[model samples]
Target: MRHIVIRNLGPLAEADVFLNKINIIVGPQSAGKSCLLKTACFCNWVEKRIQLSQDTDAFKENGVFENKFLEFHKLYGYVKEDSYIEYENDSMKFSYSWKTKVFDFSWKEEGRWNYVCPKISYIPAERNIVAAIPNWFEVSMKNDNIRNFMKDWQEARSVMTEDMPILNLGVSYRYDKSNNMDKVTVGDGVVLDFTNTSSGLQSLIPLLVHLEFLYTKRFNTEQSKNILRIEEEGTLISIIWNYAKNKSHGEFNIEKVYSNFTEMKRTEVFLEEPEQNLFPPTQGVLAYRLMDWARGEKGGFLFVATHSPYMVTSFLEKDNENDISLFFNKESKDGRYVVSTATEKEVQELYDYSIDLFHNLESLG
Candidate 1:
């Protein structure tokens, strides 16, 4: 994605913003990083679910989805006692005004109307996926395409264990509301119960399941052409069975699917200070593993907001030449917060600083 300029945005008089495939925002506390993220989420939410008549008190009071134009004017320390907020996007030169509590919001371009917004999926820093899994699963299963996909998934699972012992794969809820119930396995067998696992593990199950479904769909279409050219007839079931056997060696850890979620399979992850809770190294490792899984699948993007230098250095040591961006804010002569990206040389300096701090702490012990 490209940098989107935000003029007179929250705490930012003006900024020429650009988004990287892997964008990282590094700045001191309260320097608008989180604000930028919130704004992006708000814009995305509005674009995906626009209904003028719906109640919007939550957004207005919580500051979760403020009118963009009004937000800009407020950020710039400007206000009109009677005139309603009015703002325009120069790129599209779009304009809109909301005066009465109830009003329709619309966007226009070149005297022609277009989609006012776009869809976006936001995974906040709080990482609250477990609470939303039920709804997510319901929506996925409700779609005909997704329902058929799950049926194929059941078929593949059955064929893969034709003679081998079942791993029990933990307890999972059936999508069908009529069949909505927990599945369990007794004795020495794997159980897919999210409740019994760590939060990190539970957080990744839906993403992994979705990816598995998508991969199966893509593979079927891709393999058909090759099979036709070779004058071979093979069903998706056989293809999946062989693929699973070769990939898992007949002993798959279903938990690993969530544990290794990355954007792309092999890209580097830049984490901001991840040791906030004084969490054990194991939890930290699991978090990194999940991030790596997402990276691997989606191609790695590095832009992490962190406070833990240990996490930062740990990743750096793993890949010496890996890109590391650091942010520290200082008041400019005019008394405004100025943001800057850490260069390679600057990162090296921070690395040295971190090492000294680490050794100093060790010496104290």
Candidate 2:
């Protein structure tokens, strides 16, 4: 995303962010970092899902286009007057026109990114809740961000059958073993279910599993390779929950046969607060892990929202050297949240001296 405009959405009176490949959003509480990230993600979803191929009739009819556009805004139940999100680049311009109460999508037929619509996933700060459960139904939340994150969490957790890498927690841990299920090796001879592991591991594992599964989907694997495929529901969540509930595991597969996706050309990941359950040193590791994996997988884009200095400073390290764009959200003098952009050099110098940072969005209320 290159250009972002938010009008009268919550604390964001009006703001703009010019994004880069590996974009980082840093902010104090209620600064609307997640708001911006989610808005961008939502617009991207529309750009991908509502392709021009099937929209000739829909576009011509005003009501038809408006109705079709409303389906994607289920997360935002109602839009107050003069509130909108606009994201654009050279090829296309996408905006939610509050006055019209519909999306204004303008695109060129030959835009390259349009063909290979990217996959967007969120790793929320509440991710530990996802890994804590062996199985769960589709959870609903009033907050669209958490709700969408849960949906992705469900899909990502579905395919784990093979024993994962053990999380060394100094002492062995165990849960009620059922059906000789998957386990993580923590010690020399100790094995335990993933849910019974430490909080840090729990939070990290689902994201790792989901991204790895997606990477495989784009590169290698199919329905025949899946450990369990539920053609009835057929969703990755359906199959994954079944495995979690019934104690069965095999290689998991998320095939195009089940989803609308053919294959991933690029991935767009939004990670919120990766430093939550991690130690100071581990924050850097997790940051690099996220950046390295996404870049290595298919030269994808990454958007991270963080409150940790370690997380911010990781990009300044020698290994990552200027491969990031930092968006800092702070309250303007008039007490409205406004976002500011910093190049790599600015971020490194500012963070290196002033390690004191503010709290995250969640902690504000």
Candidate 3:
């Protein structure tokens, strides 16, 4: 998918950075890279196609009827004090056009308006995995709709015990005897804890679970449409159970393929700076693995807003085409910020500089 254009965005007076599958937004601090990612997240929220919602009371109490509003608002830099959003779509060609109006404090003065929203996930630069992990979990939980929609899983709950060590280690929800209610855990050696894991583990756990749940949910739902009973020989449950149980160690590791979605996920995962807590080597590894998974898993797209040259170089080394789009924001004479793209040669040069800097740092160590 291509960005096509973005107008009247934060500090971005008017800029257009066309996008590809693996698009990269690189720029100095406060260059509107995060702004672009937010715009894509907002678009995805509004589109309603990607089901990311919450089943919590805070959402209902706020009168936030849909999850899109919440997800759209999570993106910083968009003038949220008072804003109006509008957009259009052309499904035949799989393209969209969107506009959001950011009103100033007075509501009368126009802050900024952005056009073009894509199905993007924006991982911020600072990483802030601790704070971000919960939000990701919320999104994943809502999308999985496991709590509300997956009746089979709900029924199977009785057959399964919440006491399992692995179940407690992974992120999930459980019931409390004292309150007779459910609680979410973050895999910290039982005790229904979410704080013991490292920030990296916490952040990645939700993403992994979400992907697994999404594929599982879709496969079950679709298979049920075609099959009737639980046949011992060839049934949906057996198929998914075998598939999930047989997943391998690699990045894209499913033993048996159930549906087309499994073939090519094509999900546009937006990450701001995935290398927040990771060292240079680990950073490159994570970025490479995630991108490779997207390409191989049919999980189509990945849009990243990053300052780490190591991550960008990792993508470049993979020999993917214009898949990585670069953006740089410049201030105009009038004190306005404008976003622009870096040429292929410019990006490569920047990568080289980053590599040299990292190598020098390594030498110092």
Candidate 4:
């Protein structure tokens, strides 16, 4: 399990959450659910770069750090004077301070967690936009998060061998490589272009496709190298050259360092609003599938930020409830948003609240 503590960051006044095999954060709008997930994703990305020997210089260059880390994720504006964070997994510990704009990392060299690198992907809320526009790359966009997701969606399409059923919702998604477009198959062989699919299909297909692609290519060294950003190639070459120099002096093995760069043993995906445009029953099914996906492989992990109570309640219905960790981001008595462990009682309260609102609507008539 991974643990994180955050304070005074964006709408999150304070939060302490554990990242388990299946972690879900539910909260109201602007309550900082996305902020917390993005923070964790950024820290994990930094940890991977540090493992590749790319951190020493960036730590000194705060501007580079901000541009690459915060700005890339569109989280630059979330920092406050009192903002602070600490994240620790089995192998790495990371902390950051907003006042100094500094990041500190501690790597455990001798442990089971050592050399355990995860390929992290952030599926943004705008993923449906990519599905709607096949040639999205042609359009210029400032949001790196969505642009990166579009790239992933494109790559995922290349690897699709057959149509994918969307949660058994009586529709299947497929990619037409030759035509360079997406297609959906409905009952009785009716075919619809992906652009013409329902809002729910559009929203869910990108996420599922990306997950399938990553799962298929897990532990693939070439695939891992292919995904590396072009700017990071300089650091990658530098690390290899330094290793070669050390090898000449009998200090280290160059082959081992090279292996570290190529081998990615895990896949950690941070999903924003996974339940978007999904029905309650389908959301329940998706939640179970996500759990199975994370627990099926040794190093697979999922971190989801959602507003749907169905997604959270599904875990309670499962026998392996202990495997999932639920966090609720809500306003405290002081009117600051805080994250706390989600309980069955709280889920019931959500239902009660919804019922009350529905009653209020009925009374209005």
TM-score top scorer:
4
Query: What is the lDDT, from 0 to 100, of the residue 15 in candidate 2?
Result: 69
lDDT of 3 by residue, 1-365 (tens): 44445555566665666666677776566766776776665555443222111112232232242234434334334543323333333321112222222211111112111112222343433333323333433443333222222232232222222532222235463334554332345535345333355566445433433333332333243333222222322443354455456555552323333332122233556666666655677667667667665665445667777677777778777756556666666666766567677777666666677656433322211
Better of 2 and 4 by lDDT: 4
Clashing pairs in 2: 158-240, 166-185, 227-251
Quote each prediction's TM-score: 0.41, 0.73, 0.53, 0.83
Each prediction's total of clashing residue pairs, residues at least 3 apart in sequence or on different chains, is 32, 3, 14, 0
lDDT of 1 by residue, 1-365 (tens): 32333333344333344344344454445555544443333343343323221223343443333344234212323322222322223112211222333323334423211222211223333332332343433444332222433443343322222122211333332222344422223245554433454454344333333333333332243322344323322232243345356554645433333222211122222332233343445334533543454345433344455445555555444443343334433344554444444556655655678746433322221
Ranking by TM-score: 4, 2, 3, 1
lDDT per residue, candidate 4, 53-134, as tens digits?
Answer: 5555566566555567677688778888888988887767777777887777676644312355677899999899976776
Superior by TM-score: candidate 1 or candidate 2: 2
1 against 2, candidate with superior lDDT? 2
Stretches of candidate 4 off by over 4 Å are 109-113, 217-221, 224-261, 319-321, 343-365
lDDT of 2 by residue, 184-205 (tens): 5676776767667778777766
Candidate models: Cα lDDT each: 0.36, 0.61, 0.46, 0.74
Q: What is the lDDT for 292 in model 3?
A: 68
Cα displacement (angstroms), candidate 3, residue 309, comes to: 1.7
Best by lDDT: 4
Candidate 4: which pairs clash? none
